[model samples]
Each structure stands twice: as structure tokens, then as C-alpha cells.
Target: MRQAPVSLPLGIVVRRTPSVSRWAPWAYKAVSVIPGAGAADWQVLREDGDVIEYHAATVPLELWHTDTEAYLAGLSARVPSIGVVMRDDDESAHPYEILLATASPYECQDYADSGEELLELVPMPEGLVALIRDFVEEHHEEEVFVKRRRDKKRIDEVEDGRGDPRITQLTDVYRAPRAGRPN
Candidate 1:
């Protein structure tokens, strides 16, 4: 029988950067909001037992048997960061319309990053990491990497099948006009 998949809890950290308005006077706002200097909001959109029991915002992490290994690889990074898809609407009129969070580095690479979208490398909450580790231990099967060897074939000196130039040797060079009549 197959074991039922479980939804895990993942903690998200959002970092907000401060900046001065485009038309700010030179003096009043001399000290603009420093980039990477701001408050952090912790939200886990899920509520499991004691694991998700933390009274904070969280998202339910659903892991399938197939995706468990990949997800585990992402979480295994030295500095694991949840990719958040957030919209940056300062220049435009769109508000809160952006990609929130992604789970993998590969996905983050392809994630469209605009000046508006904020991407942060927030550490994964210990509780959430522990929760994911438990699920991975139970469902994730480590795939051993094996290098494949190319097949070796015997090389013939002459009269080879496809590589044989003798087979395609021109028999009647004169009779076979370059661009005259059909052969």
C-alpha cells in the first residue's frame, strides 16, 4: 500500500528595503532608507500540531512522493532561502501582484525579477526545517549518483558499414555529369 502524502509547514521571511521618494528634496530626506535594513515578517501559512503550532503566519507545504527528493535538495542548501514572489508596484499601479515564494534555486533563477519584486534570502525557521527533515526522512529516498560509461565498439580499418567511404566511391565520374542529366 502507498503511504498518503502529507502537507508540511514552511516558514517565510520577507525583507523590506527602504528607499527615498523619487522627488525627495536633497536635505529633508538626506538619510534614505538603507537597503537590506528593515523589519522581518514571519509567516507560516499552515497550522499543524506542535510543529505548525507556532502562532505565526505560515503556508502549508504539500510534498508528493516524487517531489520529496527535489524539495529536500533545496532545503539542503547551506543557506536555505525560500523564494518569495512579491510584486513591486512603486513605478506601476499594481499592488500586491507578484510572485510570492518559490521552493528551489532552479525555480528562483527562472523567476522574473523586476525592481518591484522583492527577493530575500531569509533563513528557514528551525521548526519548519525540522518538520521538513522528518518528512524527508520518512518519504525521501536518496538517489545515488552514478557515472555512466560509454559503450565501446570495435573500429574496422576498411569497408565499414555507415562510416565506409568505399561504398560511396564514385564509379563513373565522366558519365555522372555534375549538373547535366539524371544519373
Candidate 2:
């Protein structure tokens, strides 16, 4: 059976409640400095619990854009040492929004300004990948979906059951495992 492409790496969304002493927007700026911070949408919630949690949502990297990076950078620059719970206007436009915090706001801002929507270039450590994969596997169910086809035409035009022999030979050569033989 064919498998779906491995799911894209997860982008974490973090949220924090504003402290009573500080303004909500400023709170977000404050939080952007602690290491492992990323862009997030903020909301004032009345729920009971800790002020923040990690891995609140595992979203496709494509959903996050350079604007998130800029916002994070601006937040980090504004408050170099603390994590603040700031209100994010960008989330309002999306169907679902998650609040997140990041350590480097400048990097976030740079990414946003570049018009890039994906964030996977930043390699994730193995532990974090495991954490995210576990979260997704536990909370989400996989569905089999139709695969999209590429635009390129097939090299073989003949209707014969056999394919081009050259293709199989090339594939065999390319896919052969590295040297270390049992034979």
C-alpha cells in the first residue's frame, strides 16, 4: 500500500494569559525573549489553569507566514527579557488561531517580511519531533485522501504491459543500498 507523504513537521502554537500588572500587548512582547519562542495569536480567556502551555496546536508549517516572524521579532525587540501575552490581529482572519510565543522576534519579523509561509527550515531536535508526533497521533486521526498528480507526462507512450527497461535499470542502480554485503 502506498503511504501518504510523511506529515510536514509541526509548528507549535503557544498562548499565555496577560498578567494583571501589565498590558496584554506588552505581555506578549515580554514573553518573546525566553528561548524557544514563536509567533502566536493571543486571546483573553477565563479558564482556570497555568498561564501557558506548549504544543497547544500542531499546524501545517505552510499556514504560518513571514508576518508571524515579523510580529515575533517586534515582540522580542520590545521586551528583551520577559514573555508577554499580546493580542494578535492576524488570527482573526483564520478559521482557527493558536497563540504562540517565540524567543527571537527579530527572526520572526525577518521571516514575515520575506513573504515565506513555511518554517520547517529551522531544524527541530529529535525530542521535539517525537513530542509533536505523539501529540498529533493521539489527538488526530488519519484519513486516506486522493493524491494529486504532477503535470509531467510519462516518458513511455507505448501500451505494452512492460515499461521502459531503462527506467527500471536506472532505478535499481540509484536505489541500491550503500556497500556492506552479506553475500
Candidate 3:
């Protein structure tokens, strides 16, 4: 198929200690075998103030010239998902060399205001998405926040660490059994 010049906003940059073997480059080549793979490109960019090395590439939506979905499925069989990292060139020092794995894919528009940022786009298999979603769901939560008491009371000592023991007492102080109920 004819290659089309498509440009995607540079998002996140990721650094990894690539395997020190011939397989490293070979692995990249293998992924490139998928259709539309050539369209996806990458470039090494400057690191952030933290000195984290960064690389930017386009997410590949094809495999072996096959549809994105098919390629993703095949990748899922081998890898959990792909990872990428991002950093701003204007904000970093020269010759930075620390690689950090990004927890998620970043959106280029999200940081457009930064002006001429460097992005390392990477293709992650769909399976990685599932893993991330599951992890977030299991870890992130929304609820009321309360400070813990430093002093340990008798009831507090008896109760498990899940809930505050003073909750019942606080509720009663506000309003109790309609205030006119029998003993």
C-alpha cells in the first residue's frame, strides 16, 4: 500500500533500558511487519529537567499489513501492552539519559500550550489498556475524607482499621432515635 504522510500530535515519551541483544532492534522490526506500520515513526528527543531520556513515536495501528484490530490482537498474545514516555525539549537539559516508563498514553493537545514539546509516541497492544483500566478501577476511589485520631480509645482499639469508630457517636450527637423515642 502507498504510504500516506499522517502526523499525530506528539504525546508521551518513554524510556526503557532496551534489552542488550540483537533482539531489541529485531523486536521493533517484527512489529513493523504489520501493515501500516511504516506510517508510525519515532525520534529521540531531549529529556525533562529530571534528566529522564525520552523518545517519541507514532502509535502503530497496523500489523503485518493487517487491520489495526487484528494487529492489536496478535500483539496482545505476546505483550500485555505497549508503553510510551513524554517530555518537553525546551524544558530539559542536553544529553539527558534517564528512561522512565509512562503509566499511560498522553494526549498531545493536552500540552500544546507548552510550545514545541518533544513527544515519543509508542504503540501499545489493546491488552495493556485492559490491565491499566483494571488497575485504576481497583486502586482509585472517591469517598469522604476524615482525619484519624492520634489517641487510641478503647472502642478504637477494638474496631478494625476499615472505618472510624467515632462515626456512630458523631451520628448520635447530631440526632438520635428522633430524640423523643422510648428508652
TM-score of each: 0.47, 0.25, 0.24
Instruction: Write one digit per residue (lDDT tens) for candidate 2, span 62-151.
Output: 212323333233333433321112233563643233332332345445545655332212333445435434444444444458999888
Task: Write one digit per residue (lDDT tens) for candidate 3, span 1-183.
Answer: 653422222233444344558754311211211112222233445444433333434343211221233323324444433333234333444222223233332332333345544333345535545544444444444445898877664563432233454685423443324346674
Error of 3 at 100 (Å): 4.6
Query: lDDT by residue for model 1 over 33-119, one digit each (tens)?
Result: 111222223323334442321112234445556667666777879966556555444665323333444455555555644444545
Q: List where candidate 1 sits over 4 angstroms from the true fold.
A: 1-5, 8-17, 20-60, 87-94, 98-100, 112-118, 146-149, 154-183
- Model 2, TM vs. native: 0.25
Query: Candidate 3 at residue 67, lDDT?
Result: 27
For residue 174, what is the lDDT in candidate 1? 30
lDDT of all predictions, in order shown? Answer: 0.47, 0.37, 0.36
Error of 3 at 142 (Å): 4.4
Top candidate (TM-score)? 1
The better candidate by TM-score, 2 or 3, is 2
lDDT of 3 at 127: 51
